[model samples]
Target: MSNKCKTAISVIGIVLSIALLAISAVLAEEAIIRPALAVTFTVISAILVFVAIFYAAKIDYETGVYECRKCGHTFKPTFKAYTLGAHTLSTRHLKCSGCGEKSWCKRKNRRV
Candidate 1:
């Protein structure tokens, strides 16, 4: 999925979680004893949040590859390449192991 889709889902999950909590509060204010419904919503919201997190951390460890533009070398990136580089998707600041210089890198689709 695209970054925009991931962002949208994340926002929706957060909004749904907030709305469910607010509804629970309203039910409590009215002295309603529907514990089951409140718990159900809470659980669903938690699952949604997990899904959003999964989408946000979109690293494919199996077949993910990055190619260095400077040395024409292809290699699998380390987790730090995604976590500590310029950004999760862009690895321009990462040093090429073969070239020993910082260069732009392109992410390749995960091979099946």
Candidate 2:
């Protein structure tokens, strides 16, 4: 699966879990069997949300790609490559595959 799809699924899981939790709260106010069912559903949804978030983070860490600002080169540098210089969320110092210059590079969105 692609990073974009994984991210989308993770977002959906978060939203769904929030909605389910809200509904569970409402159900808990009433006295009936529905309250028990609501709690079960809420627990399941919360677990799903957690799993989705973990999967998305793993994908991001593994497939992070960057683009050079000085040159139009796109490359995936290793973790050591990033630590070799300096990096930030917005910019990074890495050798450009196209220009071979160690310069500040811009972070590119891995998702489509």
Candidate 3:
């Protein structure tokens, strides 16, 4: 998966876990100490930490078929990203690598 997707998922997981923990704690009455409650809290906290580590970082670039303004020849550019250990994501960018020209579809397929 892309770094953007990982980051998005991690943020969501953290938010939901915290919210659930807060709600459960507030619902407690008379400060009852229960073994199950402690277990539940531990589980949630662990999940939150795991997600935070997984997301880590993200990088991306794009490439695409383009008409070289100077040479009038079709060219291509490729996008790439690095994140999550050795994982990577890449796709064609809408720009020419040969002559640095812009393609028509430069706006499409933006990485999440």
For residue 95, what is the lDDT in candidate 1? 72
Scored against the true structure, residue 35 in model 3 reaches a CA lDDT of: 57
lDDT of 1: 0.63
Q: How would you encode candidate 2's per-residue C-alpha lDDT over 34-62 as one tens digit per residue?
A: 76687787787788777766666556556
Q: What TM-score does model 2 achieve against the real structure?
A: 0.48
Superior candidate under lDDT, 1 versus 3: 1
lDDT of 3 at 81: 17
Query: Can you give the TM-score per candidate against the true fold?
Result: 0.48, 0.48, 0.33
Candidate ranking under lDDT, highest first, comes to: 2, 1, 3
Tell how far residue 71 is off in model 3, in angstroms: 35
Question: Per-residue CA lDDT of candidate 3, range 1-111, in tens?
Answer: 765565567677667767766655654543565757866775776676565544332122221133444546554344231121132132222444565655332222342
- Candidates ranked by TM-score: 2, 1, 3
Highest TM-score against the true fold, candidate: 2
